[model samples]
Target: MALKSPRFASNAALQNAARSAPPIRRGANGQHVAAIQQAFIDLGLGMAISTKKAGKADGIFGGETESRVWQFQARMGLTRDGIVGRDTMAKLDELLPTAGPPPKPLPPAKMTHKINVHMRSIDNPTVPEFTQLKVMEEIYAQYLIRVDVLTGQSVGLTPGEQFTLNIVDGDCKWDQVSDEQRLLQNSGSNQGVGVNDIVVYFATVLREKNGETLQGCAGHAPTRPAVMIAASATDKTTMAHEVCHVLLSSSFTPVHVGEDANLMCSAPMCTGQPAYLSVAQLNRVFASKLLHKL
Candidate 1:
């Protein structure tokens, strides 16, 4: 879900501030944004990071950029509005000396010793970014069914289950992952020697507005399973998407390619194979939910 009201007083004020200095986009998807925030770090402005505010609907300027700028202002004791005024600019000059024209940022790392052309942008714009998250519960359930049929593992894919299930909202941020978040986010976590412990199930929505085929998206992680809805997603479809992935995750068993599980749900858009997938062929068990949805 996202905020409905315009968080800023006027788009003009936001526009003027952005024209002077554009808001830096930062996130796992937007490396350029991260690098720009790093510039603030270099400037000794307090911590500057991306907020979960969606950039597509509202605009990048008024969302994370403003949030980060406001943080900078707070650290500088300027009114905590996300506008980077002259004082903030001066502070930037004082703290971080102009590094010789911002160093070119390294591109998103990829595992390309030898490559297949099937790879796509992990950070590319996802279509239909919002839906009725309430439905993802069913998606997750169906995902579980798929996994059981595929893997034959002893986990619940039906209405009854041994483990308690929960669905919550918030980022499963590996770094800032709270005890609760740790349970939901799969990346950078402790899954046994040969277990995936997580899966991401995405449903195709075929949305007219965004031309997106996905109704919603959700993750079946080690500690918690999460549901994220795409715009206007129906209740049943949303739930089914996420449920499918959860079942998949629980069903997979790792045979060990290099040193990790054979299957991975999060597509590795990076240089490291084990970061998401394994090196060995038989040892791997990959989920094609996103692939199938696409």
Candidate 2:
């Protein structure tokens, strides 16, 4: 069914109803969603703020809206849990303007890249190809980029080819493996990809620099644009996090200390939370070589 447009009964009635309503969550729909969407816009965050794209405030608490909620929570130093509970709503009420010139919208980036993502796996046969593609779509939507995700046949995990990675303390380091072995593992499982494409490899496990188990890896290659996501992490945000790395490259630091909620923050404090890209990181992605904005 089509989500109805926001219909406020009256300014006073709307405020009272929203102020007294229960917490809002994913899949919520109705006037409350509309009021919250308007609140985000009033705060200068824009519509579909998490995606940073123009979209209707169509009174449905879908993924994009959920993300924006968490982003708002993060910025406000609230719980960052993505739930629009009473506390969050109260904060929103306090911050939203009573009346004034509407906050200025962020200017659109001049360039937007149209890119492709190729999926590959090694020693991990059952890659979450569809789920990962959905992640890429949602993430690119944030930057207003068009993405084409291409799935490749699964490879490796053969009886003799399965190699156990070295683990240091609690981390698993794939880089500890010989360069030749890493090259062979990546190359042998490869599928043809496009010039403006990134190869996403699903691995059984990923390790930190010291060989501690990490969630994923993202870096540039002479012949390929690549990011590796550990099938084990299981957090929905991990894939998008690594992809942000591939797009932002070394120009930006891997982590932002004060901005733990930003997509690029690798701090332990930010662990376990969904991450959103900072405006600067969004601009860097637009300027990156990996994307030939079309």
Best by TM-score: 2
Q: Give the TM-score of candidate 1.
A: 0.22
Candidate 2's displacement at residue 66, Å, is 17
Q: What is the C-alpha local distance difference test score of candidate 2?
A: 0.57
Report every candidate's CA lDDT.
0.31, 0.57
**CA shift at 59, candidate 2, in angstroms?**
22
Predicted structure with the largest lDDT when compared to the true one = 2
lDDT of 1 by residue, 1-294 (tens): 111113221233323333445433322224333333555544433231232233222223323344445445544555544445445444443444344432333222222111011111111123322221223322222112121111111122223211211332333221133332233233222233123223332222222233433343433344544333333343333333333334344444431133211122322111111112211211121232222221
On residues 21-116, what C-alpha lDDT tens digit does candidate 2 reach at each position?
545777777766877777776666555333334365677766456666765765666665566775666666555434443344334433245667
Q: Please identify model 1 stretches exceeding 4 Å from their true place.
A: 1-80, 97-155, 159-213, 217-294
